[model samples]
Target: MSFLRRLTQAFAPPPRAGLDRHLAMAVLLLEIAAADFSRSEEELGLIRKQLLTGLQLDASSAEALLSRALDRSDAAISMHEFVALLNEELDAAGKRELLSWLWQVALADGRLAPHEEGRIRQLADLLFIPHADFVQTRLAAGA
Candidate 1:
């Protein structure tokens, strides 16, 4: 590598490496939270908890990631790009598990709004999650 190029790379922010998947998952969750046009504290809390637990991230890291993910979700034109990334990165079981977590977020507000339910269903289809498994996850989430 050229010395100047190497120096530039060294001075640049370190790559997040493997965090893209985490951020994509976070974006999906955030998308669901915002789907109803009202984001509840309950849902936000659940999203933070999931980011920390599911991604094994420290609190600060999770917060930072979530903040970035919110921006990405806001700028997103469609969920297809994020869902495509997930499909490439995760196995069937992993995808199913993510769908379950999404359901948990959807149910966090005590009652599921129609828009929330529809968003979940749409995401489930995008992720290639079967309807049976989607229902099973919804039930498991106590929705």
Candidate 2:
């Protein structure tokens, strides 16, 4: 190993492997829910349901995961790190499904704020979700 590399490794703890995919997913969903500057009970409930049913996590585990996600989201510099991790871990269909979840969270308050839609659109771009798929997910969520 290079001398500087060895020195850095010796002094600094190894970086985390990366954000966990489930945590990344949760954080994204939370971000979408909060994009409007408010997170309603409905929005947070949908997110909690996603964690509970989708991941089959127990109530306690789901709550803990959500708590961690909130912490990560608050400290996050950009969504790129979460998106990059999700892109590496999730396939195309999975990304599409995640978009759907984001839409649901956005609409959970029964209105789509401009900023909420904008946030989803930005994430759609990062996830490489076609505009058609983005619209489809929005339609599905509204339906």
Candidate 3:
């Protein structure tokens, strides 16, 4: 590479791996919200709110991320790929926090379906969250 190119590359901002992780997290939240085959406006609102608050993203950025997540979630055949990305990107506490967010999403519509609970349990196991922490997060989310 040329000297100027190398210098410019060195000074350039890092790639948006953090944004990718945020997108993965948003996909998980969307999955939980859609699990019951009932996607309420309240649930979507909560998802946007969580994305804004958790990632400290501006409204536009959150919306874009949500848009991407929605597309990715739709194209996905299983949670395995999303869960794998999350496992690679997040630590234990982060995964637990994600579970908490998921519970919040599940209960956002003021009711929890049986399928939603089952989905949460499945995701928790896939994310390697301890059963105790899963229960605690469920209680914390008032689910």
Residue-level lDDT tens digits of model 3 in 1-143: 99999999999854544446888899999999999997899999999999999989999999999999998889778777678778899999999889999999999999999999999999999999999999999999887
Superposition error at 40 for model 2 (Å)? 1.4
- The regions of model 3 sitting more than 4 angstroms off are 1-19
lDDT of model 2 at position 128: 91
In candidate 1, which residue ranges exceed 4 Å CA deviation?
1-19
Candidate 2 minimal-lDDT segment of 10 residues:
12-21
| Residues 1-143 of candidate 1: C-alpha lDDT, one tens digit per residue | 99999999989854444447988999999988888897899999999999899889999999999899988888878777788889889998999889988888888898888998999999999888899999999999898
Query: Model 2 — TM-score against the truth?
Result: 0.87
Q: Give each model's whole-structure lDDT.
A: 0.88, 0.90, 0.90
Itemize residue pairs with steric clashes in candidate 2. Answer: none
Against the true structure, candidate 1 has what lDDT? 0.88
Rank list by TM-score: 2, 3, 1
TM-score of each: 0.85, 0.87, 0.85
Error of 1 at 16 (Å): 13
Report the backbone clash tally of model 3.
0
In model 2, state the lDDT of residue 29. Answer: 98
Give the distance in Å from residue 51's predicted Cα in candidate 3 to where it truly belongs.
Answer: 0.6
Candidate 2 regions with alpha-carbon error over 4 angstroms? 1-18
